[model samples]
Target: MIVKMLHDAGLRSEHAYLGAAASIGLSLASWLASNRQENLERADRWGIFVGEWAPTFFGLGLALANYERTDGEQLIDSQ
Candidate 1:
C-alpha cells in the first residue's frame, strides 16, 4: 500500500535512492559539525539518529522499484 501510494504520488525508486544517498552525506556532515561544535557523545547521537534514515529510504527505494516493475503495465497505461 505504501509503495502504491508512493508510486501514485510520482515518487520513483531513483528519488528514494537519491534520498538515501543524501541522508548518508547529511549524517556525516551532522556528525562532523556536532563533534566540532558540541561534544563526542552528542556527535555520536546525532550521527546515529541521522544514519538510521538511510536504511528506511533504501527499503522504500527497493519497494518502489519492485512496484514499478510489477505494475509497469498499469503505470505506463496511466501515463
Candidate 2:
C-alpha cells in the first residue's frame, strides 16, 4: 500500500535506484574527505553511516519496481 501511494505520488523505481547509486558515491566521497581531517575510525564511521542508506534505497527500488509491474499486470488483465 505504501509503495502504491509512493508510485501514485510520482516516486518511481528509477528514482530510488538513482538515489542508491548517489548514496554510494556520497559515502565514498564523505569517507575520502573525512579521512583527510579525522582519524581512521571516525572516517570509517562516516562512510558506514552513509553506506547504510544504500540498502534502504535499493529495497525501495525493488518494491517500487514490483508494484509497478503488478499494477501494469492488473491493468492488462482488466482489459
lDDT of 2 by residue, 5-66 (tens): 99999999999999999999999999999999999999999999999999999999999999
Worst 10 residues of 2 by lDDT: 1-10
RMSD of each: 2.6, 0.7
Work out the TM-score per prediction: 0.90, 0.96
Off by over 4 Å in 1: 73-79
Put down candidate 1 lDDT per residue, 1-79, tens digits, no spaces. Answer: 8789879999999999999999999999999999999989999999999999999999999999988888987878898
Error of 2 at 64 (Å): 0.3
